[model samples]
Target: MDPAVRMVFKNMTTDLAEQYPALVEPAKLILKKCNGLPLAIVTIGGFLADQPTKTAAEWRKLNEHISVELDMNPKFEVIKTVLMKSYDGLPYYLKSCFLYMSIFPEDRNVSRRRLAYRWIAEGYARDKATADRYFMELVERSMILPTQQSVCSIQGFDSCQLHDLIRDISIAESMEENLVFRLEEGCSSNTHGAVRHLAISSNWEGDERELESTVELSRIRSLTVFGKWKPFYISDKMRFLRVLDLEGTEGLRNHHLEHIGELLHLRFLSLRGCHEIFYLPDSVGNLRQLETLDIKGTGIAMLPRTTIKLSKLCYLHAGSGSGDNEKTYFSKCEDICEMQRDLCVGCCSLDLSDLDGFGRCEAFHLVCCLMYPNIIRGIEDSGVKVPRGTRKLKALRTLRYVHLAWGIAIIKEIKGLTGLQKLGVVGINKKNGPGFCSAISSLSHLESLSVRSGDGLNGCLDGMYTAPENLQSLKLSGSLEKLPEWIKGLQNLVKLRLELSKLSGNLETMQVLGKLQNLSILGLWDDGFKIDVLRFQTGLFRRLMVLDLFYSRMEIKLVEFEEESMPNLELLTLSLGDTEIAFSGLELLQSIKEVRLSVHSYLFGTPKSSKNGGNEKMGKTLYEMMKREEERNKPMQDKVRQELQAQLDRNKNRPVLKVQ
Candidate 1:
C-alpha cells in the first residue's frame, strides 16, 4: 500500500477511539475495514456515535463487507457516515438548509451567508445567534465543505458547499423524511401525508382521489403544482399556505376558488404559464398580504379590476393579454412603471383621460404602447407631461423600460429625471437618434443603465460607457457593430455585458480592459472576435476572473506567464470556433479553475489530452491556498468557540442555591 494511504489510515483509527469510547473494539473493526479512509470512518463513527446501542460483532461485519467487498476507500465512506449522522442529528432548522440545496443544480456552490439569511427569512433561523453559530459548526464538522470564495469569512465564517455525494444523500433523506413534496407521475398518495412543501409538475394528472389527497395536505405552506387540471373546488383548509405556484395549467375550468382568499398568510401567488385560466375571482383582491402576483403567460387576458385592492402587492408581472374583459389597473403598478394618471391601453390605442383622479403618482411608463383615451390626460391635468426632457423625477427614483420615439425631445425630457437611478429604454428608430450620453453624464447617482441603441446600438456607441462613477452594471443590448470604444473608460463599472454586437477592434481594447483592475466579469458574444487581426496580449486581462466569450476568437501572443497574473480567474468559457491556434494561449490564464468549452466536434483540441497536467497542478495549488486560508482563519474560529464555551461554563458554574 502507498505510504500516504497508510498514514491516512492511522489518523482515522485514533480519531474513532476518541469519539466512540464505549464502542472501542467495534470502532477498531470499522477502522480496519475503512483502511484509514477518513470518509468512511467518520461516517460510520458518527452514525454509531449517534446510536445508543449496537453490538460490536454487528458493526464489525457490516464494516468488513462495506469496506472490503465493495472495495471502497475508507476516507470516502467516513464522509458518507458523518453526513448521515449529522443529517439524522440535525434539528429542523439545519435540515431545511440541507434540503434546500436541492433547489440548485448539482455541483452548484451555495453561499453560506446567503443560505443563512434565507433560513432566517423562512423563520428557521429566527434566533440569529443559534443559527449562525451552528451554521459554522456544521461546516467545521465536515457536513459541508466551503467552496472557492472571495473572503475567508462572509458575514461570518466562509461560504459553504456540499459535495455531490452529500447533496444526493440530503435529497434522499429529505424525500424519506417527507420534507419535500415531489408530485411526479406514478407518485403514490401514501407519501402525501408527510410532505410539507409540494411541487406538482406538468404531467401530474389528478383524479378526484388525487384532488382529495391534495386537499388533505393542508399542512403544506408552499405548493407549486404544474399542469392545467380541471377547475375543481379548493377548500380554505390551507391555513398555513404561504406560496401557491401553479404555472402552465392548460385546462383549468371555472374554479370555485372563492375560499382561497381566506388564507390571509399567503404571500406569493403564481398564475403564469397557465394557458386556460380565463377569469380571476374578485375574492383574490382580499389577499392583502400578497407580495408577488405573477400572471404573465396565462389565458386570462384581462385581470379583475379589483386587483388594485391588493395594496400590499410589491411585484406584479402582468404582461400583454387579449380578451374582451376589463383589466385591473393598479395606481401602484402604474406609479412604479412611471405611467402618469392614465393607463395606456395597447390594444385599443386609447389613453386613459382621467389623470387628475389618480390620487398620487411617482413614476410612469408607456413602453411600445400608444393608446387612445389618452392616459396621459390625467398626468397632464396634474402638470406632468410625457417626461420629454432630462428632468429630475424628484418625487420618483426608479424608471425602467420607458419607451419613446428615439428623438431629441424625449432625450431632453429624460435628463430632467435626475433622480432616476435605474433607467432602461429601447431606440425605436434604426437610424440616427440623439444619444442620452451627454444628458445623463452628470447623473452621479445612476447605478444601472440598460439601453438599446439604434441600428444595433450604433447611435449611442461613442458615449455609451459614460455614467455615474459608482455605476455597478452597464448592459447594452440589441444590434451593434462593435464593442463601444468608450467602454474602456468606465473604471468603476464591475459588470459589463454586450449583446448582439459584432466587434472587430482588438488588442488595444483588450489591453485597456486588463488595466480596469476592477473588472471581474466580461462576456463578449454575437459573432467571433477578429483575434488574428487583433494585436493584444492575453496576459493583459490580469484582473479578469470570469471570462465568457461565445463565438469569440483570440490570438495567442505569450508562450509563458506567471500564474499570479490572472490570479483570480476561476471560470472561463470559450467557444471552440473553426480555429485551433486560439487555445495555445489558454495556459496563460494560470488562475483558471473551471473551464466550460463549447468546441465543435471536428475541432481537434490538444487541451483535451495534454493540458490536464496544468489543471492538476492548478488544483493542488488551489487546495494549498485554501488550507492556508483556513489555518489563517483558525484563530477567529477559536475565538468564537472559546466565547461560546465560556458562556456555557459560566452558566454551569453559576450559583443556584436551592431554597428550603
Candidate 2:
C-alpha cells in the first residue's frame, strides 16, 4: 500500500479501524482506488471520518461505490468522482455553504468576517458565530483551506482560499444546480430560471443591456461585481437584491449609487475600497433592512443623518483599523505619486503648441492640487461622523472608526449600544477622555476595543478606571503616562498594541503587562518606552509569540532576555538605537524563529542629546545631521547583526536574522 494512503487511513479512522478490525480489509480496498493521489485520499478519508457507522457492511458498500465509479469514468475523473462523493456525503446544513464558495473569484483570499456576514445575509446561518462554525466545518472536511490564522487565538482563522480543483468542482456543481450564475467573458447569460445570485467576474465582457435582456434582474437576490463598475447594473431593476458587494470596483462614483436606496432589500452593502465615492445619498435611509455597511477605504467622511433609520444595522466599519501607520500613510502617498507619473507621461506625448493639450494639462494639474491635500488629511484624520440618534442603533454589534470630532455627545450615544462586541473610535482628546471611558465602562460585551488620541500627547487617557472584562484585543494610539491599572485585570486579553505612548521606563507598566497570562501579540511603537536598559525577567511573557518594539527617539543601551522568559516567542522585531546596545541572553528564546532589526535614520530632526547640549545642531542642515547619524549607527548595527548571527548558529532552530 502507498505510504500516503496508509498515513491517511491511520489518521482518519484510527479508532474506527481498531474497533472494527473486520472492516480493515475493505477500507484498504477503497484506499487502493485513490491511485496514490493525496487529494483523493484525503477527501475519501475525510468522508469516512464523518461516517455514522463503522461496520463491515458499511465499509464494503463504500468500497463498491468507489470501484464502480472509478471503473465507469476515465482516469482524469477519478479525483472529481472522489470529491463528488465527499460533497454528496456532506450534511444538508453545510451543502449550501460549500457551494457558496463558488461566488468568490478563483484563488482569492476571502476575508473570514466578510464571508460570514454574507452568509448571514443570505440566511445560511443565524449569526456570525454560527456562520463561522459552518466555515470551519467545511475546512475540517478538507473542502476549504485556511490561508491566514486569526490574531486572536480564540478565532480560528483570518482568511481562506479554495484549492483550484475544489473551486472547479464547486463552480460546476453550483451551475448545474442553478444555485449561482457566474458571468464571465464570452459566457451566455441565458439561465434555466431567474438568476438568484449573480457574480460578475473581472473579465466579464457582456454589457448591462445584454445582461438585462437575457436575465431577469429583479430576481437577483445578490450581486457581486469584481472589476470595473457597470453603471447600468445598479438600476432600480435589482429591487430584490439582498447583497450588493461592489468592493474594490473601479469607477464607482457617488452618482452611480444615486438610486441605490431603491433596493430596500439590501441587507449587506460593501463599498469598501471604492475611493472615488465622496458622499452617500440621503435616500440610503430607505434601506431599513441594511444590516452591514462597510466603507473602510472609501472617501466618505460622514454618514448621512438618514443612516440613523437603519435600525437593523449590526456591523458598521468606516475608517482605518489598527495596522502599520507609516506603511498605510506611504501607500496613500504612493497613489498620489502614481497619478503624478501618469500626468507626466501624458504631458510627454502632448503637442506643446496645441491649445487643447495645454488646457487638458492645466485641468489635470488642478485636479492634483485639489485631491492631494484631501488624501493627506484623510490619512491623518480618518473616521466617519455619525449624526444624532445613534443611540437608536441598539442592534449594532460592531462599530469602528467613529470620529469623536463629531462631539462628546457621540460617546454618550455609543454607550447605549450595549450589544457592541467590537468598537473603535478615533479623535480622542483630554476633554473627552472621561466621557469615552464612561461609555466604554457601559459596554460589558465589548470583545475588541481600539482608541486613538487626536494628538500625539500624553495625559489623554489618565482617568480610565474601568474597562470591559471580556476584551480579547485592545489597541491604543495615544500617549499615556503609564499603563492603566484596570488593564492588569483583563485575563482574557490576547492582543495588545500601544503606539506613541511615551511611557518612559515605567517598571510598573512592564510588570502589569507581563502578568497577562493570555497575551500572545504585543506591539510597542514610537517611543512606547524610553529606558536605557530593558530586561525581560524569567517566566514573564510565557504565552507571547510575537513581540514588536519600534522606537525612533529613545536610545536603549541594552535589552536583556532572561532564561525561561517568553519560551513560546516565535517572532521578535526590535529597532536599533543610535547608541550601541547589547542584546544579551539571545539564546534564552528556545522557540524563536525570526528576528527583525530595523535601523531608522533621523531625517526628520536631529535627536536631542543631553551630552551635547540641546539644539546644538540647529546650524547644520537636516540632510547633514541625518548622514552623520547614519554613519554613527552603522557600526552598532553591524555588531548587533553579528551577535545575533553567532547566537542563531548555535541554536537548533537556526532562526532567521534580518537587519534593515
Candidate 3:
C-alpha cells in the first residue's frame, strides 16, 4: 500500500487491480524490489502491463524472477538487469530503432520528424508513417520519453528524449552489435570494425589525420555531427553515406560540401542551422537518391538550378525568416523591436495609409525593403524558387516556404506535384491567385498549407472555394472580405492562424471558427478582425487550449467569455492598447492555467496622437480619460485577480496570471 507501488498498479493495471484483487499483494512484493527508483518501477510496470494474463500466480512468478535477478547481481547491476529484461521483451523491429537513439547527445530533444526520416533512410522502416508507428510503440513501452507535443493535435508528440539510464543501455547495446560508433573529445578512435553510423560529439580535439587513420570512413552509412565540423570528413570515400546530419555543426563552410555530390546514396541531408553557408555547390545535383533536404535558418537564398534534377526529393524545407545578415535589418523596424522587448507578439501591425497600393501585410514587407535596400534584399529573396520543370519531383511530400514571385509559371508547376502533403508559399498576388488556388485544389494529400499575399493585392485568396479536406494546419496572411467558405469544411483542422486578414468584424466568421471540433490553438494577430468587441459565446471552442489575440490599431473595449465557452482553454495571451477593456468570465474556464496580458499605448512606430498643437491637446484629453478609466476599473482588475487565485486554490492545476 506504498504510494509508489499503488501508483504503478494504478497506472499499469487500472481495471486489473479491481478485477483481480487477490494479485495486489504479489504485485506490491515485485514493485518493492524497485527500491523507490521511479524508472525501475515504471519499466517493470510497463513490462507487466503487456502480460497476457493477470492472475495471482503470474504476479508471484514475476516477483520470483525479480528476486532471482536481484540476488544474482549487485545493486547497480540489478537495475540494469531489470532494464535489460524489458529490452529483451521488445520485438526485433523495435530493437534497432531503440538502439539508434544513442546517436543523439545527452538531454537533446530529438525531433519526431527528424528521427522518422532517419529511420526510413536507414532502411528500418518502409516510410515515415511506418517509422512513426515504431516511435509510438517505443514510447508506449516507456523506452523513450516525450518532451513536447505538436501544435496540430493530430501530429502527436513533436519531440522526445531518452532517459540517461535508457540511453546508457542503448549505447552499450549499439556498440556491442557494432551498429553505432560515437566519437567524443579524447575518446579512442578505434571503432572495432565497419562503422555503419558515426556520431561525433563534444569539442573534438583530434583532427582528420587521427580520424582517417583509425576509423574506416568508406562504410559509414550515417554521419551526425554535434560538435565541430572537419572538412575532410565528407571526402569522396564516404560514398555509401545515406544520412549527413550536420545540423548546428560549427566551422562548416560552403566549400566543405564540394564533395557532397559524390555521396550518391545520400537520402537525407540537413544543414538546418549552418549559418556560414550561403549557397550549395552545383555538384549537389548529383544526389539523385536524396529524399529530404533541409536548409532552413541558413543563409542560402536561391538553390542551385540543378536542384530540379532531384526527382526523388520528398521533403524540401528552406527559408524560415530573416537569416543572420537580415537580423540587423529587422532591428530597424520599431514594431519588431517593441514586440521583441516586451510584448513578444508574433506578428506586427503596420499603418499602410501612407504607403499607396499596399495591404498591411504587404506594406510591412515594402517598408523593410525601403529602409535598407541591401539588407532587406536578402530577407525578401529568402524563399527558395520553384524551378522550371519541378513537376518531375512527383515524390515530394513537403515543400515549404517557397517564393511565389517566380510567377504563375512556377506556381503552375506545383500542380504536377500531386504527392505534396504540406505546402507553404509567400508573395501571393491577384494576378496568380486563380492559378495558385487551382494548383492547391489539385493536391489531394495536402495536410498543411500556408499562403501569404503579395504587396498591393487584395482578394488573392478569394478564389479558393475548395481545399483538401485532410488539412490540419492552415496559416493565411492577407486581406479577405470574409473567412473562406472552404475553411468551414475542414473538419480535421487543428491549428489556425490568421494575420492581417482584416475580417471586417464579421460575427459569422467567429461562429464558423467556433464550430471546428479539433481546433486546439487559435491565433488572431495584427487586426485579424476589425471588431470593437470580441466575444466567445456559450458552448463554443470546446476543445480550445491556447488562444492568442494581438491587436495594434483596433481598440477592443471588451473581451467577454460567455459561460461554458472555452472550457478546455489552458493558456490565454492578449495584447491591448491603453484603453479600459473588461475581461469577463474567468471562472468559467475550468481548465485555465496561464493568462498573459500586455498593455501598450502605441505600436508599429505609429502614434495614436500627432505632435501638432491641436492634436497634442486632444491627446492630453484622451490620456486623462484613459487614466480615469483605469482608476475606475481598479475593482474589476482586483476581481479578475481574485477569480484567478480562486481557481488556483481550488483546482489541482494552479493558474498563472501575468500583466505587463
Q: Considering every candidate listed, which one attains the maximal TM-score?
A: 2
State residue 654's C-alpha deviation in candidate 1, in Å. 60
Kindly list the per-residue Cα lDDT of model 3 for residues 292-394, writing each as its tens digit. Answer: 9999877665678898899889889887632111121221234333533432222254455886543444444445445546543434345665667888888
lDDT of 1 by residue, 234-330 (tens): 3456677777666555554334344567877776676665644444666786787665565654434334555556655533443322111121122
Q: Report the Cα lDDT for candidate 3.
A: 0.74
Predicted structure 2: lDDT:
0.76
Clash totals in order = 55, 0, 0
The reply for model 2, stretches above 4 Å from the true place, is 1-37, 40-73, 150-156, 322-381, 504-506, 527-531, 550-557, 571-582, 591-645, 652-660
lDDT leaderboard ranking: 2, 3, 1
User: Alpha-carbon error at 397 in model 2, in Å?
Assistant: 0.5
CA lDDT, every prediction? 0.52, 0.76, 0.74
The estimated TM-scores of all candidates read 0.50, 0.74, 0.72
Higher-ranked by lDDT: 1 or 2: 2
